[model samples]
Target chain A: MNGILLAMILALLIPIYEAWQDEDIWQKMLAFASIATKTSIMILVVSVLRDDWMIGLVGVLILSVGNAALMLLAHIIRRLNEA
Target chain B: MLENLDVVAIAALLPLTACMLVTQVDPYHALIIRGILGAVAALVYALFGAADVALTEALVGTMLSITLYAIAVRSSMSLRLGTLATAAPNLDAAVPSALGQQLFPALRQAIKKHHLRLEVLPYASPQALQFALENKEIHAVCVPAEQLATTQGTDDVAAPYLLNVRIPRLYETLAAALPPELVAVSFSRALRLTSAAPPPPDSQLQNALEG
Candidate 1:
């Protein structure tokens, strides 16, 4: 279980590096989306590994709500470009 | 201790994302990185058996704060430029007028380097435009040299358009970036309280006031 979690953490680093290096706003936003989703999934995996329902529920909430925030941010950025 | 390697790795990501957020130069980019930081923070909190803290971090710290900050940065980081209505008839149109063709693109390009948006507002007369600048309603005013009485009979007459910027930093940016042959950029400290009455254009003043 720990090995799987470590692998997921390694997967997460790919987007973090992308976000840090990319100069384009859209690319950074894509990286943000990747990070947001990956972190919530990691949370879920950890919750399951420990058999903690409370942590699992929080992970589910973040997974759903984080995307909504991402959508709102994307709309704002699109509108910004239009003007 | 080796069994806890995953926890150490996950916890380390929190500081990494925070550093990324702080190092970002652009406000919009920083806001995106802030969202990334919030995500990593929530993950770290959940890993440490603080589910409630994780949820709060995700909901308020990540979602609500980033949305609000994005809106704030978008609206505040723009330069509001007042121009004569007659000079830029098709400013908002797909194909701008000849004057706008010369001005807007160059202005936009210059300010874009600083990550600031250009918002062009039209006024019926130069007085109203100047009034708007003095009132802090706009950051700068761009008018034809012939239209402004104060600019007439000066060396600036060689230039067709005169751009009066109230902020020194904006003046420096425009003066440095814009071609002098295109426009004359000057800085004015007109924001000071003045006893002189505004040029009597009651209707235009009303429009400026409302806008």
Candidate 2:
């Protein structure tokens, strides 16, 4: 368990570094969506381990809905860049 | 199991690393990194047995705020224009400094006409002025009109032809209003110019440069 936690923490740095290196706005948005997905998955994993359905449901909500707003923003930025 | 606790500990550390990384990146990049940081925070909250807080972070911190930042970044651009004013005005003083006497009024008019949120930054010397522009610290440098004709002949100043990024179309407009002696050189072109040769001569930017 301790090892998994360590790996997960280390994994977060990957996206941060990706965002840091890229200048394109779309790529940055994609990195953010990836972060949201990873977080939701982590939450779900923890809830399952703890045998907590309530926590799992919240995780599910984030997993499904969090990216919707980001997609909209990405679209908006794309349109703005086009115009 | 003991293994699960270990996993949670490792998972808990990811967001903290992300939190630090977010600050180091540019504001545009931060917009994206912030979302990931939000998600990592949520997972940490869940690992700590706070599902509710985690969910809120996922929604508010990751989703909502990223959108807000995107909107801000998309609609407007911040410009740092170098100026002669070393400091803010001193109303107590009987006479305004030369920077006040010359630059401010014209800049104020340009800001209103062009709808720019102009910030006047002071540089210690010409080398510092050029360094700041080269490093992308400031958007442009506002030099006295006469300085444009003299310094512009050199390779250093000639590189960009001094076009403003925010108002690419304003070169002609500015030329008319400001004294024929003063000119606003656009520093934003450094990146674009470095990648390619000067733009076509007929281009508006070229017109600004020729003057």
Candidate 3:
């Protein structure tokens, strides 16, 4: 279980590095989406490991709602490029 | 000690992401990084047996705050430039005048360096254009000197076009970026004073140029 969690952490670093190094706004947004999803999944996994229903519920809510913020941001940025 | 190594590693990521957020130069990019930071923070809070904090961080910190901030930054970090309807025709139309062709691109390039977007608005007459500038409806006004000279019955206008900028910082940026040969850029003091004094309709451009 610890190894699985550690590997997931390593995977999370990939997008964080991409977000930092990439200059393009869209690319940074892509990295953000990846990071947001990955972190929420990690939370779910931790909750399962500890058998904590409350943390698991929070993880589910974040997974569903966090991407809504990403969609809103992307729409605004798309309109920005148009004007 | 070794049993909690994974928690220690996850907690360490919090500071690493925070550093990345601070080092960002662009506001838009920084906002995206901020979302990323919030995600990581929620994960950390959940790991520490704080489910409520994690839920709040995800709902309010990551979702609501980032959306609001993005909208605010997009609208505020822009330059509203007013020009004659005849000169621009429409916001997206290709400007036919030689000065428009050269000046617009230069202005876009100059303001782009400061991470500001350029928005062009067309007004029917010079009076309306000047009115917009005085009322603080727009940041700057661009007019053909020939048109103003024809209206005023004087050919003393030296430059091909005139650019009146109301904001001092914007005036400095435009003055530095634009060539004098392309257009005459001047700071307008009408915006600085109280709105009680109405601008004289006919010589508003001249007044803007002089004071």
RMSD of each: 7.1, 14.8, 6.7
lDDT for predicted candidate 3 compared with the true structure: 0.84
Candidate 3's C-alpha runs over 4 A off are B87-96, B149-159, B191-211
Tens-digit per-residue lDDT, B27-85, candidate 3: 99999999999999999999999999999998899889999999999989999998765
Residues A1-83, model 3: lDDT tens digits? 98988999999999999999999999999999999999999999999999999999999999998899899989988999888
Which consecutive 10 residues in model 3 chain A have the weakest lDDT in total?
A: A74-83
Give the Cα-based TM-score of candidate 3 against the true structure.
Answer: 0.86
Each model's lDDT: 0.84, 0.60, 0.84
Off by over 4 Å in 1: B87-96, B150-153, B190-211
As for candidate 1, its clashing pairs are none
Location of the lowest summed lDDT over 10 successive residues in candidate 2 chain B: B191-200
Worst window of 10 by summed lDDT in candidate 1 chain A: A64-73
Q: Predicted candidate 3: interface RMSD? A: 0.7
